[model samples]
Target: MQRKGPDRRALETPRAAGLAGVVFALLLAATIVLMRLGIPEGVEAVGAGGFTDSARRDAVRAALALIPFAGIFFLWFLGAVRAHVGDVEDRFLATVLLGSGLVFTATMFGAAAAATAVLAVAHPAGSAPSLTAWDFGRHLAYTLMTDYAMRMAAVFVSSMSVIGKRMGVLPRWLTAVGAVTALLLLFVSSNVPWAELVFPAWSLLLSAHILLVSGRRRRVTLT
Candidate 1:
């Protein structure tokens, strides 16, 4: 009987996916930070003249520009994760992962659109947005991001952690961290200013793990 060599393509796919996940995590974290700094949560100040500041407006524009790229990379990350999971994935958990990820992306985009709307309405220098418009846009953007998108992200994280635990792909501590991240996103994100950052933190750790595992497998295959 002749021995077959390792499949190079199969070995490379996980590595590529891991890189994409890392990029996606960095992009998302940057986007969140920029948006938060640009749009401070103050109903009265924002309604008055806070947005008229050039620096804040520019920060918001920068954040808006990064959003599409973040979303693009996120889709790539999602696809890579699915590929890594392969055919052995549980249908119910896989469905939850896919659905929640998609929803999170869409909801994130919608939140960006709401923020853009605030900018659009604020155009024409020396003119501040009406209280009603400012309040609506601000609340809508935050609600979509913190309320809807974060919750969907929680589901995605929880499902992925469950799948990884069952498949023995993730360490016990990593899975435990994912569970804690999901709980924070689900219950604390809306109330805490920076709680949503946990999602990206979890993503970065997972991506780094994936990359490490892929590197090890590649070395073993090449030897």
Candidate 2:
């Protein structure tokens, strides 16, 4: 009598991670947009006492509200990817991916916290925050977002690109795009306004790709 192997095909399921990635991409993009609009960087975009404007303050609060859910979906995406990779995943690259993603989430939260502090100080419905409070909170939030979170995002992109290349799962164009995204996050995002948008753009594209590929795989399997 011959021993039978477990049926791996039976374990196949819809790629929930890919869906989670899509959701994460959308949520993150919206959050970033709300934050930028709320706390405009240049003098032209926002003047003194900008925080006193209830509209901008509300935008910031909305962004803060979305951040935690975005982070949760991001973690879910990471875990799903790891589980999908299974035994074939490289330990080193996987470590970098997870570490960078974790740090990115943490730094984003830190930025949100800083923004919240600014909002707290600019309270009383029509009063400007103390100049010191506004300056410190704004700079801290901006620094955490542009400098720390984006740098970690760069690492995450690079690591994912490498892993996808090695796994032969990601297409050549996607890998190239990831490389460009990583570079943008690493250098341009800090100096250039709105450059950080590339990160979410890349994420959206990648997630879409994953979903398409998974659909193909399922079709082939069923056939």
Candidate 3:
């Protein structure tokens, strides 16, 4: 009986994951920035009396439009990474990773929905939402994004870091960066504006590393 060598398709998994991850990172970061600009926090958020400006409303709409694509690419990245890791993955950590990623995506969608509610306040079309409606919608959206979704992102980052450490796939520096990112998401993101950006930044770094590693491997295989 003859056993075949590893399938060439398998080698492409890391590349796919890398590309997906890069796209997800960029999209998510842009969405977050737009959302924040559209729905600013603090007393000024209420002071401004909310979305009187059509441009801000449009920015929120753009952010909402980007959310679905960001989530899709994130899922693709998640599945590809899992496929790349394959049978060597620890069951418990894998479960944690999958669970957190799913939760994060759902939370992001919830935030987008809340933001959409704010946009719909165009009751007669071009009319600003009542202050109360604006406040509630903005609060709900930020809460879901920073408090819930970012926490889930933290869980995903930390768990991936642990797995990478055990598997020796990620470099020590990258794992360290992941640890910092998780901590920031868990503790700082909810309180500090723009802190959630770390998650996407970390994702971009990880994706770049994966692409570099996979490219080297493919080159070596060819040689």
lDDT of 2 by residue, 1-223 (tens): 1322222332232267778888999999999999998988878334448777788988999999999999999999887877776457779888899999999999999999999998888877668877787888888999999999999999999998998899898999999999999999998999998888898888888888888887887777557
| 186: Cα error in model 1, Å | 0.1
Residue 26 CA error for candidate 3 (Å)? Answer: 0.5
Which pairs of residues collide in model 2?
Answer: none
TM-scores, all candidates, are: 0.94, 0.92, 0.96
TM-score of 2: 0.92
Tens-digit per-residue lDDT, 36-119, candidate 3: 888889876864345777788888889999999999999999999988875798799999999999999999999999999988
Candidate 2 Cα outliers beyond 4 Å, as residue runs: 1-14, 44-47
RMSD of 3: 1.8
Instruction: Give the candidate number with the greatest TM-score.
Output: 3
lDDT of 1 by residue, 151-205 (tens): 9999999999999999999999999999999999999999998889999899999
Greater TM-score among 1 and 3 belongs to 3
Measured on C-alpha atoms, candidate 2 has an lDDT of 0.85
Q: lDDT of all the models against the reference? A: 0.87, 0.85, 0.91
Clashes of each: 0, 0, 0
